[model samples]
Every structure is written in C-alpha cells, then in structure tokens.
Target chain A: MSRHTIALAQINPALGDLERNLAVHEKTAEEAIARGARLVVFPELSLTGYFLKDIVSSVALPLTSPFLGRLRDLSRRIDLIVGLVEETPERLFYNAAIYLSLGEIIHVHRKVYLPTYGIFDEQRYLAEGGRIRTFRSGIGRSAILICEDMWHPSAACVASLDGMDVLISPSSSPGRGGLEEGKTFANARAWETINRAYAQLFTCYVLYANRVGYEDGACFWGGSEVIAPSGDTVAKAEYVSEAILVADIDHAEVRRARMANPLLRDERIDVTLQELERIKREGAR
Target chain B: MIDLSLNCDLLRRVLIGFIVNEVRKAGFSRVVVGLSGGVDSSLSAFLGAEALGAENVWALLMPYRTSSPESQEHAELVVKQLGIQSDVIEITPMVDAYFERFPEADQVRRGNKMARERMTILFDHSAKLKALVLGTSNKTELLLGYGTLYGDMASAINPLGDLYKTQVRQLARHMGVPEAIVQKAPSADLWAGQTDEGELGFTYEQVDQILYLMVDRRYELSDLLEAGFDERFVRAAFAKVQASQYKRRLPLIAKVSSRTIDRDFRYPRDWGK
Candidate 1:
C-alpha cells in the first residue's frame, strides 16, 4: 500500500469571484503539498458560489474551458478533486466532480441524485445524471459522489459494484440549528451503510468534505469526516473553520478484511439488478 | 493614523474566508466588478475572487478617453494575477456626445459625467452576463460622502463598506493581492493626473486609520490625537463618516402605516417569496 495524505480545504469563497477563489486554491494547494498531502479536495460548487444568481448561466464552463484547464495544469502529481458546475450542450448543468491526477482529468462524476427540497432547488438548475461509476487509477480504486448522492444507499451500492476501495463525497450543506451535531449525523447517516455494510462485509474507506460559511441566509457547516473500515470516524475537521483533514489508509487491512469475509463472492445480483434496471429505465423515461 | 493591526493575518484570512462563503450563499455564482483601474474597484475584484472561484469571477474594465494608460496597465495586472477575465470598453464617445449638450460644466461636473457613464456600461454588461455587481467603496469613502450616491456607491452587493481604508490595505495583503495595487496611490482615474489623496487633501492611510479608531475601534478623538494622529485629519474623518451616515443606510421612506419598503419588509434580493 502506497502512502497518501488527503487534504481537504474547508474554505468560504465569496459570491462570484473566480480569480480570488483560484488564487486561494493555488495558495492552499501549496500549503497542502507542504504538509505532504498527495490528494486535495474542496467542497461542492466551490468554483461558483452555490446560489449562483444569474451568473451561473454565464460563468458555467464546459470541460475545455480555461477554468478546468488551469486546474488540470495545477493537478500534476497531486490527485485533486473539485466540485463545480459543468455546462453540457444538451441543456443540462451537471453537478460534477473532476478527478485530477498527473495534470489530467482521470474521471468525472455527475451527481446521480439531485436534492430539491428546502433550500435546494437543484432540479431547476442541474440536469440529473445516471450511471454511477468508479475510476480505477494506477495506485488506488476510488469513486466520486457529490453531496446529495451520499443521502441514498443506491449510490454506495453502485460504487461498490465498481470495486471501489474508497468513496469520496464532496458537499455544501447548510448550517442551521445544532450545526456540528447535525453535520456529524448527516455524515454518519451517509456513511453507516457503506462503512458498516461495505467496510465490514466487503472492506473500504469513506471520505467526505462539507463547505463552511454564512451564505445569504443559511450557513454551510463545515464538518468533514473520514470513516474507517470499522465504521468509526478516524479523523474529522472542525465544524465552522477552514482547515484540512488528512488521513492514511492501510491497504493491507483492506485485503485482510475482505478475505476474512469473502462476502463479494456470495452476492446474488440476478434478481436485484434486473429489478433495479427496470426501475432505472422506467424513471429515465 | 488608523490602526488596522486589529485585522491580523489569521483573523483577516478567516474573516475573508467567511465572507466569501457568505456571498456564495447569496444565489450568485459569478461577480462582474467594474474595474475603473481604481483602488476601490480593484479591492472589490480581489475580494470577489476570494468569495467565488477565479473561474466564476469576471472583471469589466470600463475606461473613458481621459482614463490613463498607467491605470489601465495596473487594472490588467490585477486581473491577470488573479486570473480573472477582463474587457476594456472605452466610454469616451458616450460621455462626450451626451455632455456636449451641457458644455458649461466644470471639471468636477465633467468627471461626474464620466463616472455615471461608466456605471451605465457596467450594469449593461452585468445584465447580459447575469453577474452581481460588486461594489468597491471603503467605509471611509462611504462615511465622508466622497462617492457618487448611486454612481460609485451602487452594487448588488458590497463586501468592503465594513472596512475602513487602512484595513482594506491590510486585507489586500492577506489576500495575496498584487503589491502594485496595494502600494499605488489611490485614484478614481476620472481624469488625468488626479489622485484620491491629492484631491481630497488627505491620504487614505490617515483618513482610514482615523475613521477606524473613531468609528470601528470606538476611540475618542482626543485619544486618536494623543495617539499621534493630526488633529485636523481626525476631526474631518470623524465628521465625514458621521455626516454621510444617511448614505450608508437604506433609503428611509415615510411610513404612514406599519411597514416601509426596504426597512422592515426585506427578506431577500427578490421579493418572490
């Protein structure tokens, strides 16, 4: 198992200032690198302010846009992930995660689930994405999911299907009443099934980062967490400050844990997969 | 002299990080700052990028004929270092032709004419681009009534009105803002050879420090002078922030009944809810 330090930037970006955000990323990435981090991550919609007034339409960029290009240039040697708005010509705005390594975008994940209740009008601005997949890089196996994707069991199930060793969920969650406890609860809720079922039954890691700030009216509580194989939060960033949470994974533990259970071999997918496919096709139509 | 050491490196960075997140929550993905090649607009652009990502921020360089190339160069440098997109639009024709009808105006009037014209172009692009206009005026400017009411002072949102002049400079550094912008003499660039300190007969460092200690820091005038600030500068700065208190506030409309427009019944930028 190779050593890698994952650094999370719990930053509060201003509304609609692309230049300043980029500079902050550059500076912070340097700091993370100095701290010996090989992987760096930012919260959901870190590029454009989350609310994104009308500017969302104009500032929205395609993959080839200068914005991602700059990030691509910066991602050399550092495995980096960022949450941003990706404009698709099909009249769809994807809540996307661009996974970068060695200065190239290895894989991009579009959010499978879009939240539309209370303070989230995602359906109005973003197009829903299907087909949850994971990327197998040379070093480790990982999967990407935005904030709302963690809310469902199917997301982790889909990622496990791809044999992901770890799942990274970047988020921008509002901070209101009982902020820290609420975020901790949300992280546990999203991770319990994956960490306990998958980590114990199949064995894997769960990584997540939520943004922090007093946005228009609602504040984003930044309480990022890293859940280990035993379903315990091994490490976590504080709730309301800009800080990084770095953690290491012992790959040997993964092989040891999975072999002890051999649960993947006992899976019965025929009935369940067919039924899920039927639901998926019907929902898409 | 103003004391800006209160906004220390860590405190300033945290405050900046927090506000950037605040603006992000306000339903704006991008900001289009009118870079007049002046201190106020430059600071606004820098802060906007910190609040949003550099990719989501845009800067519009609206220059008039009298606008100096030196200032334009500075504006370009600020945008380039921050990695923001910028466009230079010359507003000379629009201003000159419109003002040709009222040729008997003085330099101040002509300068104001250019200022208003520049704002018009800014808002037009803002509408087309769907960006929130980021205001750049500092607290000292807001207080002393140095800015045009709706012209220079207008913005969909402003992040700097809370900071006095000296604090703005200190923040500029923590932001890793280009030194050229932080060190340059303040200027509105409305006309050639015009400097903000020279025109106002007081430097920003003096006025801002004075305003901060007097207002934000809540120091007495005698204390400020005792602390080595010139008596005249302290008095003028305090009076300005006090006299222009009206400009800093939302417009007050007479209420015959229960609620007034912007005072009691404000929830969001849009009243749809």
Candidate 2:
C-alpha cells in the first residue's frame, strides 16, 4: 500500500471516563473507515484523558483489557494507533501507545520520557518506559513517540536509525505561552517547527495527533497534522477543536526525499555510540 | 510599563471553548453570573452569553444600597444588550438586617458581610435554577488576594481567572463591552467612593507590571530592583502575593491517613465526568 489514506482522530477525551471515550473512539473510527481511510490515529491518552493524577491507577488497564479488545476489534476494519495507560502484572503504570492491525496488537511503545515540569505530573504517577523501537505496520515501517518523548531528539534519532519510514507522535500538549500573530499559540508553533524538522531530517512521513478540550483549567490545543518527507504539511487540523484530518501519503515520496537528501544514509551510528560511551566513562571519573 | 496586551481575538475563542466544553462536561447547559457592572464580570457575562446562547445565561445584578447607581445601570445595559435573563435583587435589605444587631461593625466588616450575602444568593439561585456560578475574579485580584474568601471568590468555574486586569480591559474592549464599564475605575463598590486602586495604594498598571515580572516571569527580587522597579514597591507587592496565598487555595484538612485529600488523594475535579 504505497499510496493510502490516513486519518488523524483529533478528539477530546473525557477525563477518567473510559466508556464515553470508547464511544467517541468507536464513532470516530467508524467515520474514518467510511471515509476510506486505511488507518486512524488518536492523541496521547486517547482512551483515558490526560491529567489522570491519582486516578491513574483506577484508569490503568492491563493488556488483556476488554477496552483494548474493543479497539482491537475496531482495527479489523481500519488500523488504529491509540494511546492509553498501561498496567503491567507487576502493577507499574506507563503512558503507552498501541498499534492495532488485523485485530491484533502489532506494536506497543511505552513513553520513555515522562515530563514532570510545569503543569505536567506524569513522573509522579507513572513509571518511565525504557524502550524505543520501530515496527512494521499496515502503512509502512513506523515508530511511535508519546508527547514529551518527541521533544528529545535522541528518541527520534533512534527511531530513524531503527529504520522507521513514518514517525507517529501522539501528544496531549497544553496550549501555553502567548498567541503568535493573533492566531496560533507559541507552543503550537514550536511543535510545528519540530515536526517539520524531524520529517525533513529523517526523510520520513510525520503523523502528529494532538488532543483538544479543557482538562481542569488546561486546554489541549488540537492542531493535529500530517507532514510529508519533503517538510511540507499535507493536512492540518484547527486549533482548540475536534477534527478528523485526512491525508493521502505515498511511500514513494519518502524514497524520493531520501534519495535527494541522503542525510540518514551517511549517519555514523558507531561514531555516536563510541563518543557517548567515552563521555559516560570520563564523567564517571 | 510591561505590555500586558493580549490577542483578544484568539483569547476569545479559547475562553469561549472553555466555557462551552467545561459547562457541558460538568453536565449543565446553563450558567449564572453575578454582574457587578465592572470590566471583569461584564466581560465574563459577554463570553458566557456568546458561548452558551444568551438565553442560557442568567445575569444577576446584586447591588448594595451604597453601590453607585451607574453600576446598576451598566449591569442592566449588559442584560439588555445581550438579551439575557436578569433579576435585580437589592442586597441592601439583607445587609442592613445583619448590621442592625452589630451597630459597631466597621466598614470592612459590612463590606465582607455584603460580599458573603451576595455569594449566598448566587449559590441559592444556582441550586434553584440548576446553573453553575461563573466567577469573575481576574488574575490580579487572585494573586493580590483582593477578593472576599467564599464571596465573590466562589464559583464552579472562572473563565477570567487567568487574565490580568489590564488584559481583561483589552478583552473587554474587543468583546464590545460598553466603553463606560470598561473605562470606569474598578471598585468593589461595597461602600461609596471606594475604588480598588485607592484601597491598594497603587495603580493596577504598575502592580500588574510588577506581578508579571515577579510571578509570571519568576524574576528575582534583585533582578526586579535592577530593572528599575522601586525596591519598596516590589517588596510590598511580593509580600502581598505571599500573604494572600491561603485565599487562593482550598481549606486545609489535616492529614490523618496514608493518603489525604489534595496531598495524595489527588483526583482531577473532572473525575469520571
């Protein structure tokens, strides 16, 4: 499927209300399927809303959860990448994203970075994820990064090196700072820059799905977008509202961009690893 | 002065979304706001009327006997302009009835009593009408603790809580609030000839600048002084913010268990909604 339609489900999940959010997911996924989309992506914590605080334990679901089973069934019609709070048998909670295809969970990426600064308290309630890997999906070879994880370049670098053709970011970022040019938020503009830079540098399609609506007093600005490997935004959603943005992406473009730039091809991973090791050893002294 | 200007156009959409989404999430479609004819309350009323249709918004004009007649007039102006449902309930009788027993009650005491009385009426109406009380306190008053605890400070949600007084004026003008209310000197109007700046002993313009630096930007006292801010004024402004911290928080509950409310039992207010 070189050329396929993808949908960004930019929804506002009700805080701690899983049933209502599931209903929203079902409705949005049905619409995406009806629109001839092969895959639909939701924002971080799409199943359980962001700012879960002490209620994280109550909303945390094991991999065997029927909630996820419903999404897995929905994926039989259209592939899904949904964010949720994952609970291990050991009872540790993580901010996780699951890729469902063919009625099976294809890949699960536990968010490696837990932001604990300024309005974010994820570190206080959840354990840190320690893995970053790319996996095969219905679209192409893809990697998942939760909100704060994408802020770190090393995470995206690892995904690119691991041979990801598409970098999907699910974010529940709050709108802050000030408005830029009387329209977009400064923070939202910053995210756009980051997404475009990663798409151009990695020569991969960037699929950014951000949530909208108010949680407590913080408003999550949903400017979900799809950027091509050439650093061009193919489709963008409106801010502070729910939207299902759809865009047709061709893997041939990723091949063409990579052939033209060839930056990822010349990357020296051995040199980077050696330098990082040397720095760690020297700093230990 | 530091430019506290905001993009009122963008801010209007964000705040309107907040009012509409939050009220619906809390399972209500109607909201009641106590219209004081001041910029903050009037701006909130305008947003509420625009967010949830004017018919869903209820404006209550609760004026004390000593409140300026223009205050009532401006509040009525908002009601008529928005075509919202409104009722004028004079707080004079309720206030005077309580002060009758305590003849020696000072002006501050009387003012506090009136504020709490209005809160009582607002809450009572909230229950009767099944509407949420929209708060009108701005960031300047919240940071300076320039409001009565459990009085005008009480609300189910506050759309103006994050905006400073200067920003509130900018938004008020953008939202087409009457120029008279927007330009009027801000006053609690608990008594005659009383203004907020007069009681604070400084202009909101100066204090808002200081607060923007001290609180929002996290500027050190030394940095503020080096920025040419008067040392005395900066210190006093910081002190007021520190001293009034309690009014901005919920009542303290002494912890007796493993997980106490607010300390560890921290579920969001929108829990399960």
lDDT of each: 0.71, 0.93
lDDT of 2 by residue, A1-285 (tens): 599899999999999888999999999999999999999999999999999998899999998887687888888999999989999999999999999998999899999999999889889999999999999999999999999999999999999999999999999999986662364677898899999999999999999999999999888999999999999999999988899999999999999999999989999999999998998999963
Tens digits of per-residue lDDT, candidate 1, B1-273, equal 222554244334444554454445555578888886656677778777766777767888878877888888888988888899888888888888988998888888888877777677778877887777777878778878888776888877777776667767776776776777788888877777888888888877767666656765569987987899888877777777778888777787788767566554433342111
TM-scores for chain B, listed for all candidates:
0.86, 0.99
TM-score of 1: 0.51
TM, every model: 0.51, 0.98
Q: Give the least accurate 10-residue stretch of model 1 chain B, judged by summed lDDT.
A: B264-273
Best by lDDT: 2
| Ten contiguous residues with the weakest lDDT in model 2 chain A | A177-186
lDDT of 1 by residue, A1-285 (tens): 555577878887655566777787777778888888888888887776576645456557787777777778778857778777888877568888888888787888888888886667677667888868888753378887888887776677768767887778888877422112112334334444444554564467777777776555445667677766556676788756778777776666667667776665566678778887998989974
